[model samples]
Target: MFVLWDADGNEIRDEYPPVDPLDILRNPENAAFNLDTIIGRLKELGGSDIVALHQLAQNHYIVLDASTKDGRHYIVRIARNSVTSSTSARISNIRSYVRIALDFFRINAPDGIGSISSFKSTANARSGEPILGPYILPSGLHTPSNVFESIEEYFRWLISVKKTSTTVGTTKPDLDEAQVTLKKLENLISESVSGYRYDAELLRGVPSHQDFSGHNVFINGEGLITSVIDWEFHMVKPAVLAADYPAWIRYNGTADPRFVDKTSQFSSYWMAGPLDAKRLRQEYDAVVKKEDPEYHRALKAGTFCRMAEEWLLSDVVDIGCRRMKAWLENSLE
Candidate 1:
């Protein structure tokens, strides 16, 4: 169903429990979409409704709360872009769904990155930009026609994408500085993994979710994570590169500058505030250390790796690069 690759981009076996989607669906509660109870086990999650609306409007899901005559609770979700009063728009979204389903079935061991779908790079033709592929990220930066070969190559492409994705690449001073900062940070990530024991694992490729955020996750009155929605943008990438603690658990990433993204501040992942984040991040460490020592070690070695992945996936390139350089200079040195 999914492909796996090592640092060298060669096909590998999915040794970890065999990547089968059915194994997940075989679980009865998940098989049934009953959102009423499982999520109720969770203590804290969603708060603001306006935030929910914001999520709805952002080319994401338009969630409809509905109840049957029997008072059975149900939540209906559809792509925001798919909701349409006109026949044309609905037809287009239908076409998009067809493309996505076809792509899903055709998955094999692909070495390069980017979606197989061909779509107009920009919705407007007046822009005169040569049509690009689906490789354009959620941030609007386009990947090269030749897909990114490795993380180092991706870092370079990312810096260039910001500066040059326009018809005329920007030569602005700030963007240039951003490029320089990104380059330095990229070098730090490269150095951290080069010739290291876990370098292969750091660069090993696997199927990963693009946005594992709070909004997409649904819980009932209790705390169980009954459902997780929004899997439209999935990618195949290295493990460390895909490593990010989801948004609900995300804090300032690191409020203190001392750890350099180290496990010294080890705790469980998952919670709301900065204070809780710290304790969980630490508490997670002790538990992982005793329970899953291998994962704990991977977490320890992947500090730089995870940070690099985060930088690439940042909402804006310039801001992400600048902050990355500032943090790593102290941590990596």
Candidate 2:
């Protein structure tokens, strides 16, 4: 929930109640005064022109399209939570990492990645209450970096670490059966992908937007990507694990064709034709081979490892888990 003002200082307020009734019942107090601080800050920032205001359900962030007194348009992302305390430090850290990575990508892969404006945090002038972000990002259409080379090396290193890491997070309580299934799959991969060596030093600490998808990317009039939003899930991952195409493109069996078309239009580097998992995997295989001649076996195994990791870590039982399980079993056979 937040307020937006148009260039003429015409106020527009948006209040979205949680979709789930349980959410309301659980925290009735959550409804009141969510946007006061943000509204005040908007006023201070001289952002008065309201072009658009809407709530994004995926993250519960209010996306406000408004213009300043000087007629400069900006996209303001306002989160419900405050960013000042230790409890929300992870959010700040992730944003910081993303900022650095975006800067790197802008210089290194200008055509591959979109740009973002500087982020600023402030408290409501009246109440002194902190808000997560009034972060301003450029509003424009963009495409994902479908080119796998950018993160392929990083993913391979990540798979090796996960395979050998002793400090893996606590095991899920109901994953006994899943764990057994994964062990079998792992053993099969180990046997099939013999002599696979992982280099930890190749392009270490490369950043990957784990949730890269059409939903977060936008394409402009020139068919070039102008922006990539939603940086909450960005992380530094090994090239091998990070090199995979977006999950949406890889697993689009149930996605809307229109959605696929939109993604393909801007993701020219990878989506040269209709979305085909086999063909995409083949393309990725070629990419892996180019990076390391002996990585064919490792690439297949690493993909399975990634699917297994996703299955194990997901909190909800959904079609994704079923698909991963089916893919893992089929690959082993």
Flag regions of model 2 displaced more than 4 Å: 1-176, 185-195, 201-203, 252-301, 318-324
How many angstroms is residue 205 displaced in model 1 relative to the true structure, after the best TM-score fit?
2.0
lDDT of 1 at 279: 48
Which candidate's TM-score is highest?
A: 1
Error of 1 at 176 (Å): 3.3
lDDT of 1 by residue, 135-236 (tens): 545535454576566766766665555444332224566556666766776676667777355555456544455655544455433333445575667666
Cα-based TM-score, every candidate:
0.50, 0.37
Per-model C-alpha lDDT, please?
0.43, 0.38
Q: Write down the lDDT that model 2 would get.
A: 0.38
lDDT (Cα, tens digit) per residue for candidate 2, span 127-203: 33222211122233112333223333223333443333322233453244444544664565454334344454322
